[model samples]
Target: MVQAALQYERQRRGLGGVFLDEIARIERHVSDAPGLYQLVEAPIRRATLRRFPFGLFYLEELDRIVVLACLDLRRDPQMIGVTVARR
Candidate 1:
């Protein structure tokens, strides 16, 4: 996520902050409504970031959400799935 922010920051000033703010907003949504998203894999659910091509993969447990990965949507679907599964 730092890498992404850096890349965005390089592209334009304050863009990285914008990206991070969007991430925080989506994270809060996930925290507020754990089951609001659909499952991406057997036990993993995905919450897509607004205005960006990234997605947050997580596992909804009995008491908390375990974040698996923050991945780029532009990558190969199989690769993203594998990355999230490994985490």
Candidate 2:
């Protein structure tokens, strides 16, 4: 996510901040309603960012949610599956 922010910053002056803000907004939604998202894998759920091509992968647990990854949507599905699996 930091890398993506840095890349966005390179593209424009405050674009990185905008990207981070979007991430925060999406995170808040996930925190407020973890079960609102679809289950991509067996257990892992994905919350996609509104303005960016990134998806936040998390596991909804009994007491809390566990964020596994914030990955670029452009990445290969197989690689994403592997990375999420490892986490």
Candidate 3:
């Protein structure tokens, strides 16, 4: 996520701020109630960014939520699965 924001910063003056705002929006949604998000797979839920082409993947546990990945939507889904599987 930081890498994408840095790239946006390099490309434009204030675009990175836009990304941050979207991230904050997503964060608020999660922090308010993690279980509010829709499930993506069997055990994972996904929260999408409002403006940017990114999504946050997470898993809710008994006591805490685990953030699995912050993915740039431009990447292939299969590649993303491979990347996430290793972790």
lDDT of each: 0.92, 0.94, 0.81
Ranking by TM-score: 1, 2, 3
How many clashes (backbone N, Cα, C below 3 Å) per candidate?
Answer: 0, 0, 0
TM-score of each: 0.97, 0.96, 0.84
Clashing pairs in 1: none
Model 2 worst lDDT run, 10 consecutive residues: 35-44
lDDT of 3: 0.81
TM-score of 3: 0.84
Q: How big is the RMSD of model 1?
A: 0.7
**Model number with the top lDDT:** 2
- Give candidate 2's error at residue 37 in angstroms: 0.6
> What residue runs in model 3 are displaced by over 4 Å at the alpha carbon?
none
- Residue 67 local lDDT, model 1: 89
lDDT of 3 by residue, 1-87 (tens): 788899999999899988988887887788779888868775888788877888888888888778888898778978776766665
> Which 10-residue window of candidate 1 scores lowest in summed lDDT?
34-43
